[model samples]
Target: MDILQILILAIVQGAAELLPVSSSAHVIVAEKLMGLDPTAPAMTLLLVMLHTGTMFAVIAYFWRNWVETYFKSPHERRTNLIGIVTATVATGIVGLTLQYLIKHIVANGDPHFEIEQLFGNSKLMAAALAAGGVLIILSSRIKERSGVELSLKSSTLIGAVQGLCLPFRGFSRSGATISTGLVLGVSRRRAEEFSFALAVVLTPAVVAKELYRLVKHQGIAPGASFPSLIHMAAPGLLGMVFSFIAGLAALRWLSSWLESGKWYLFGGYCLVASLIVLWVN
Candidate 1:
């Protein structure tokens, strides 16, 4: 990708990565609009790099709260740390298990990434978008009914949604997890905090897996000759920096909007956008 493309992708990555909209869906759509093949191994690597950038943004933005909540009291810290770890492990297990089941069993050992294939599959995308949108809209509507706070069960449920999200692009991990949290009785602010914390920890491992795949494939030769990793690096890094700043800003806006319980707005957007994707594709 050229610098201009990188910038466009970076902004989209930054905004959508944290937004209730599916970042992967937006990115894949952008790639298609640019006439780029989403299945290219080199492109996969670049995509992971973009995720890495946003991961940093999550960590940087949430550092103080994480440190305070997770590292201040010895006992409380240990407990919260274990809770986070437990939830993360649960998410990983679900994600990896689903990935294996699909790759080894359902796909008959095919190594294809599901998102790359299904993203442009308008029917599937529409279904997932509609399903996720319904769930999010319903969850937002129910948040006030059950006024309970967050706990381990809610966290695990959110993490499980995150895990399930790994195999599907339009599913929107954050959207699902946050919705899961809300439906399970977690407050909006706490749900956002936990959702992002889980993302911060999980993104690196996901990136590493994609990177290893890229290296094994060797030489970026797909629809177009692969750009040098070095060339890709600059854009990825620049994307990360830009994303971090944008994420900080988005966080502020999200906090207030989240309190207003306007999550259904995003659901409506997804529903409409899904239709648009169907029409375009």
Candidate 2:
């Protein structure tokens, strides 16, 4: 890919990754439009950098807020920690179960089958995107009640929604989890905080998996020069800088829309994006 393509993807990944709209969908769409294969080794390396950039952005943006919210008191911290754990457990159960079903039933027990096999299916991605849009729209319409604290049940439901997002590439994890929180009467601020907290926990695992998968795909010998690996990953550093900047900006935009009750606009955008994905394919 050229410098222009890298810049485009960086902006897209940075902005969309933190937004309620699906970042993966946006990135894939941009890559497809540029005739780039996401699974290609170079692209895989780029993706890792992009994810790393966004993860850093999340920490930078949310650190202060998390400190105030989660670390205000020992008891409060413990309670919130338990909620996080519960949600994570729920996400693991649902995500793993879906993968198992897809591998066994959909793939006819093929040991080599990965859920990624269906990722390139345009129809499925569009359907998932459309479904997510509807969910976001409906959740946005529900009046947010202030002082409505998040409960374990609500957190569990949100986690389950996150799990559901795992296999569907176009379904936004932040979108689904935040929407579930709203549906359960969580305030916009709390929902946003919790959703991102879950993200911080889940992202490391995803990054590791992507790294392992891409390394295997690259088929590099154990004795390969470290600089050679760095060189391959270097094209993405510029993207990382852009993605990080974009993530901070996107988070502000997302907070504005969500706080101002304009979140339905994201859903509207997702619906249009879904159509575009289907149409282009």
Candidate 3:
């Protein structure tokens, strides 16, 4: 990819990743329009780097608040840890189960079938986007309830919803989790905080998975030379920097809209985006 394409992809990834608008969907559409293969190893590597950038953005934006809220007291810290652990475990279980089913059953027991193969399916992406959009819209319309904390039930539900997002490109993880929290009567701010915390916890595993796939596909065995890995990663480093900057801006935008009771606008945009994807494909 050229510098211009990288810039566009970085910007799209950064903006859509945090805005509950499904960054993967937008990035895939952009790649398609640019005549690029979204499933290529190089492209996937860049995409993973972009996600790493956003993951850092999440940590940067939420660190102070996390310290204040979860670290204020020992009891609070323990409670928060329990919630995070529970949610993460649920996410893993559900996500892995879905992945197994997709790979084995949907792919007709093809051992080599990778879930990334579905990433380029525009029709499937449209449906996932539409599902996420509807959930966001419905959650936004619900009356804001007070005094609800991140309990086990709420966290489990949120994580399960997030897991469903894992195999589907256009299913927004942040959107679905936050909406699930809202629908379960959790406060908006609390839901957003928990949602992003889950993201931070989930990102490292995803990044490692992508790196493994990239290295394996490049025919690099375990204990490969460092130079080869660096050469492969070099093209995506600049994209990561660009995406980091854009991701911070997008997070600010998301927070503002969410606080201003304009969250439903993102849902509207997603609904329109789903149609656009369907039309384009």
Candidate 4:
């Protein structure tokens, strides 16, 4: 891809990543429009790099708040740590289990089947978008309780919902997790914070997996030339920088809407977006 295309993709990914919208869905659609193969090794690697950029954006935006809120006291730190760890463990288990089940079901007797093959299914994306939209809307209607703390049970529930988002492109991870938290009576701001924290923790593993897939597909064995690896990663590295800037702006926008009780507007947008995707595809 050229720099111009990369820039456009970066902006789309960065903005949508922080919004309660599905960045993957938007990026995949952009790829399709650009006549690029969304499942190609290069494209997948670029997508992960974009995710990394937004991951950093999350850290940059939330670090101070995290320190003030979760790190101010020993008891607060311990509580937050336990919640994050438990949620992460739950996410791993559910995500892996679902991936295995889906692969087996789709593969039947073929061992070569990969879940990436389904990433371009527009119909599936539409369905997932609708589901996420419904969840967000329902959760938005619930009353926000004050002084609500993150509990193990609520965190696990949020993580489980996040796992469901893993294989479905249009199922927004933030939307699902934050909504799950709200449904469990967590406040909006806290829910948003914890959801993004989980994202920062999850992104590195995703990036590594994509990198491995790219290298394996390219027949780059262990001890491959550093120059060749760098050459392959160069375009994505440029995209990452652009994405980081866009991500910060998007996060600001998202935060404003969330704090102003406009969270349900995103749900409405998602529903409309689902129809648009269906129509365009």
Candidate 5:
């Protein structure tokens, strides 16, 4: 890809990554228009770095809040840790099951089937975006109760919702998870925090999975190919830096938008965006 293409993907990813907007929808559209293969090893590696960049942005933004809340005391640490663990377990169970079903049942036992191959389907992405939009709109209608807090059950439910977004490219993970938390009566602030925390925990595993897929596709032994793979990642490192800078700016916009009582507008935007994706396709 050219420098312009890399910059476009990086900025789109950084801006959309933490927003209720669907990043995959935007990225896939851009890739298709650019004549880039979404499933290519190079693109997959770029995706890993893009996600890593946003993950760092999330940590940077939330560090103080986390230290004060989740790490303040023994009781807080224990409780928060359990919440994170249970939610992640729930996410794993649901995500793995979906992967198996998609590969085995949906693919009719096709040995070479990979869900990532389906990610660039514009119609499928449009449907996923529409689904996310409706969920966000519905959840936004529910008012957050003042005393409601995160609970184990709610976390599991939220994580399960996140799992539903795993296979589909255009479904917004942040949108769905935070909406689920709101639907469960958690305050919006806590829901956003927990959603981001879950994202931080989940991103590394995603990066690892993408890396493995890249290695597998390349027919390279992981140990021997390490240096070569690192060399190939050099261009993506630039994307990571660009994305990190954009993410910092986008994070502030997201916080302000969330507080502006127009969040449901994002749902409306998603609905319109799905149509635009169709047109672009």
Candidate 6:
């Protein structure tokens, strides 16, 4: 990719990764529009790196709360830790189950495949986006009616939503999962925190999966022969740094705005994005 493409991808990764929007959807659209090969191993590596960058941003932004809640417990620290672990486990089960089911079941009979096949279908993506959007809107509406507060059950529900998001590229995992928490009575701040925490936990697995694919395909380590990997990494790192700085700003802004319970606005965005994707593709 060119420097301009790198910058654009970085910006999209940085912003959309944190926002309720599906960064993957936007990136895929951009790839197709730019005539870039979505199946290229090097490009996939760059995407993983971009995800890692955002993961770092989440950690940097939430370090304080993480320490206070996970480390500074005067009592019940063990319980809190267990709750976090249970939620993580639940998320993993759902995510991996769907992944395997799709790889084995959906693609079972196919003799040929393309990397773009990872996206499944645009129509499916559109449906997922719309579904997630409605859930978010309803969650926000519920918060307005009865006030929002998150608990263990709500977190589990969010984890369940994350699992469903694993296979569907455009579902917006953060949006659907966060909205699940909100609708189930999770506070906006906690919802956001849990969302990022889940991201951090699951990111390693996602990167590993992609790496395994690279190894299987090329019969060698990735980033070895692919000069594009190096090129992609540079801008990915730059974009990640920018995203971290920008995320801190977004977090501050989101805290107050979320309290106003305007989550439904994202539904409109998803609806519009769906139409745009359909129109283009």
Q: Count steric clashes of candidate 2.
A: 0
TM-score preference between candidates 1 and 6, better one: 1
Error of 3 at 164 (Å): 0.8
- Clashing residue pairs in candidate 1 (N, C-alpha, C atoms within 3 angstroms): none
The TM-score of predicted model 3 comes to: 0.95
lDDT of 3 by residue, 12-115 (tens): 99889988999989987898899998768778888899999889888999999899988999999998899899988999899999999998888998988999
Q: Considering every candidate listed, which one attains the maximal TM-score?
A: 2
Q: Give the distance in Å from residue 180's predicted Cα in candidate 1 to where it truly belongs.
A: 0.9
Model 5 error, position 30 (Å): 0.8
lDDT scores for all predictions? 0.75, 0.90, 0.89, 0.88, 0.87, 0.73
TM-score versus the correct structure, for each prediction = 0.87, 0.97, 0.95, 0.95, 0.94, 0.86
Per-residue lDDT of candidate 2, residues 1-281 (tens digit): 88899889999998988898888888888898899988887898787788888989999999999999999999889999999999999999999999998888989999888787898888898888888899899999999888888998988999999999999988998899999999999999999999999998998889888878876776455677999877777788988998999999999999999999899998999899999999888
lDDT of 5 by residue, 69-174 (tens): 7999999999999999999999999988998898998798798898887876889999999999999899889887899879999999998988989999889999
- Whichever of 4 and 5 has more TM-score, that candidate is 4
**lDDT per residue, candidate 6, 1-281, as tens digits?**
77677667766776777777788888888888888887786677767777777777778888898777567764546665565677777877887787666766778846564324768478877777777777777777774334554556766767777888877877887788778777776667777777887888888888888878867888346546577555546755665666566556655555556777667787778878887777777
Which 10-residue span in candidate 2 carries the lowest summed lDDT? 214-223
Better of 3 and 4 by lDDT: 3
Q: Candidate 6 lDDT (Cα, whole model)?
A: 0.73
Residue 235 displacement (Å), model 1: 2.6
Candidate 3 residues lying further than 4 Å off, grouped into runs, are 219-228
lDDT of 5: 0.87
Model 2: runs farther than 4 Å from truth?
A: none
Q: What is candidate 5's TM-score against the reference?
A: 0.94
List all candidate RMSDs to the true structure: 3.5, 1.0, 1.6, 1.5, 1.8, 3.1
> Candidate 5's error at 208, in angstroms?
0.2
